[model samples]
Target: MNKRVGNQTVRLESKPRIISTATIVGPKEGEGPLRDYFDTILQDDLNGEDSYEKAEKSLLYSVITAAIKKANLKEQDINYLFSGDLLNQIISSNYAARDVDIPFIGLYGACSTMAESLGLASMIVDGGFANHAVASTSSHFSSAERQFRAPLEMGSQRPPCAQWTVTGSGAAVVGTEGNFPYVTYVTNGKVKDYGIKDANNMGAAMAPAAVDTIKQHFMDTGRTPDDYDLIATGDLGKIGRKITAELIKDYGYNMDNIYIDCGEEIYDAEKQGVNAGGSGCGCSAVVACGYIYKNLLSGNIKKALLISTGALMSPTASYQGESIPGIAHAVAIEFGGDKNE
Candidate 1:
């Protein structure tokens, strides 16, 4: 009954299975290296919606539906829905869940919402609280830009360090019974700030938090980087990824063998115009729900550690010159290791 594994880690005895997953991405992301993994690719970022917010909501709804459909469940069959977005008051998730009959739990962890929601969903099912639950998140370049930086129409020149916001959404269906990829452990993170003020440089602000949570995960699990076929940070992009890789080395861990950032993996830095890489809540969501999930099913990766990072800063806080704080949550998932009994 006691699932606490360490100061920050929880070992889920039930090992809730990831029943199904779905990913939808914008044209830019669809053009990236992991294009084949995504379920739907929009020719236009708006997805026929007049506003980016509406498009993001649509993306969230579509992916959540797709995941559930893949699991052969209807909305009435789902016990709980955990979702969020970067929009103000998380309107994308709130409005999308507006029509669903399932109990809704809105989350807010910036770009880390995907992992935050997924971790909680897995726990709920693992604790016998639900038979089936859903976790999802979404983000859009236009919506995020207008809120966090400048309006897209203004065409403001962004600095080289700025990463592109991923216009996409991802969802996963978690169930108590299945032989699919299982959620074994979750390591929650602490908020960290290093006096970084520029919103454009989120990777730098968030790198320390990624490093801290990952280091804590290793310490708690007694597992090295080699234990996982892949160790992915949510959206540290190039700068944050480099910083995390270097800082983690100081903790006596060598992650170079299998470590990668979802941001960098989402886009081709050489061919894409995206300055550093991709960011936003959708970055890790789509990557994990699409590429990683498929690989797990294919037996290409028996184990994976997904660490989603977030820069906890509001426009008002940033305007007041408050330094950005970062947070990360790591979920340990494995296939062919355990089955629901």
Candidate 2:
């Protein structure tokens, strides 16, 4: 259900396009240091049985509120909300969205929630089912840790390639096609695994998925890396980025000049304890909303490809000796036409 047009690839199933995106931090704009607030929320008292759910809710609220503020629209005007998180039954997103007036459609794509949301939202807008729609996703460290591994105070050491879950949220609004930023292309990835046992090395586990999507994007569009001003991946840590580069080179594409990974872009490796980079649903969302949007608005970069990658294996699946499955989806965003350039 996908086709290519000129140098762009479009998904017939995912039409319309994203108009505006906003990402926000939970603990207010000037609320002390970013890392400090995240740590406090994780360690502080929260009135939920599940720490992860609490954190997730907080982040989701921050993102949705930010999206509303940035888009300059009232909550009631939004007809539908397509959202997802890592928690069971999407408790965090559901609880956070309850106060909003829009209808809700919960989704699950592990780390690929953003792509799923954008895809569905675009379809709704393109099909004339709705004019304005919002898609969002979130994740937190404390909640993800407790649910997937050990308690917060377990004091376990992460592997070299381990990625810290980003404690934030991201949301975007998609409207009917116009002069706004449009989703020029999209490509879905099949689940692929490398059979890596270490839970910490998500980069090793997810590298295959990243490569698969990047390769497929080129194949589907018949465009090389040179066509994009920047080819970005969601949360591929240092390890995964390297692997992705190798894979792209093997496929006869050199993405060295215009490649960026959200995980590596957000935090400083030396300053932060993160050995490789950041992960979780928030990583890609925040970067796209905050950094990418800003750059696009200011004309710093245009024609960017955002590929959100996810590890499809849960703790239970890993415990059962199941190989980690991963998936990724690529969405191209273009700002201004030749006139602006």
Q: Candidate 1: lDDT over CA atoms?
A: 0.93
**Model 2 residue pairs with clashes:** 52-143
Candidate 1: stretches off by over 4 Å: 338-341
Give the per-residue lDDT of model 1 (tens digit) for 190-295: 9999999998999999999999999999899888887888999999999999999999999999999889999999999879988889999999999999999999
lDDT at 182, model 2: 66
TM-score top scorer: 1
Writing each residue's lDDT as its tens digit, candidate 2 over 154-271 gives: 8988777888777777888887755566665667677888887777877778888888888888887777887788888888888889989988898899999999888877667656
Overall lDDT per candidate, in order of appearance:
0.93, 0.73
Candidate 2: lDDT over CA atoms?
0.73
- Angstrom error of the Cα, residue 177, model 2: value is 5.6
TM-score of each: 0.98, 0.87
Model 2 clashing-pair count: 1
